[model samples]
Target: MNTDNTLLNAVIGAVATIGLSFLGVSPVIGGAIAAYLEGGESGNGIRIGALSGLIASLPVAVILAAALVFLPLTGDIGVAIGGFVLVFVVVAIGVGFTVALSALGGLIGAYLKENA
Candidate 1:
């Protein structure tokens, strides 16, 4: 497989993810497409997929970071702390979901590539 193209493929997949997300499609499809394009082993596919997910989530991470930073400036300390924790948890879960699903999709894509 051409390992050199992995990053490019992942970027394409991230673009796909961003585009399809507007239509309510899952990021898994994007991940699968990336791995399929890479045509590598499962491990490599996972790496590509995870990278894609991470790339796609960059804007989200930035927004979440902003929220975290600014939330503390609002009103009471107790409310701010609570808001911070909630946002943190939401960010963690969202990132985790994207990465995990993308990895699974990569595995599936690799399996498909091997069999087909």
Candidate 2:
């Protein structure tokens, strides 16, 4: 694999994620576009999409962690998991969601490009 091209694709994916995010569009679309432009095999798109999704979710992970820090206690000891654990779980899920969606998008785009 060409590391330089892969890195380039990842960078493009990141930029797409950031820009599409501000446009109220799903960042996965950006990942798909980047992977499509990268023009490698399907697996390449998947890898690039995953990278993009992970990077795109960085800000969300930070925001979720910050928000979880100020939890109001409900006096329910049973439901009181450590804030760190909760935050981690939420952020992990968010990352997982992004990765899955971005991967799907990448797969579709690559397929279309290849078949076209």
Candidate 3:
């Protein structure tokens, strides 16, 4: 519930994401862990999950977006741009889905902690 705990959990969640990525893992699991550790209300859990996901994915998103720059080297610039836009859309949706799933997990964790 405290701001300090929230920040700590968010940092842990971000680090967990990076570690899990090496094993081709999902961010939702890490988000849940962070939220569970946070141990607040369901709303707080959801907020922590969303925050965690955002933090966790930020660097990867930036790198992937930057990689779009190389698309122009192989073919038509117009097509490349269009393809990049489409891929960007997909990535955005994927990010949203990841955040949503993390929120769900966080809610579950919150409930479990409350019931326990």
| Residue-wise C-alpha lDDT for candidate 2, range 4-111, written one tens digit per residue | 476677667767777777664465686787678766789977877787777778888888977655654645554455665787798999889877777866776567
State the weakest 10-residue window (summed lDDT) of model 2: 71-80
Clashing pairs in 1: none
Sort by lDDT, best first: 1, 3, 2
Q: Each prediction's Cα lDDT score?
A: 0.80, 0.72, 0.75
TM-score of each: 0.87, 0.73, 0.78
lDDT of 3 by residue, 2-113 (tens): 3457878877876786678765445767677777888879998888877777777777678778768887875897889887997698679867866776677577667776
Model 3 bad stretches (over 4 Å) = 1-3, 22-25, 72-75
Which runs in model 2 stand beyond 4 Å of their true positions?
1-4, 22-25, 66-81
**Model 1 Cα RMSD, Å?**
2.0
lDDT of 1 by residue, 5-116 (tens): 8888888878888888875445788788888888878998898888888887787877987897878788789989999899889888888888777777777777788788
Residue 51 miss distance in model 1 (angstroms): 1.5
lDDT of 3 at 111: 74
- Model 1 residue 4 lDDT score: 63
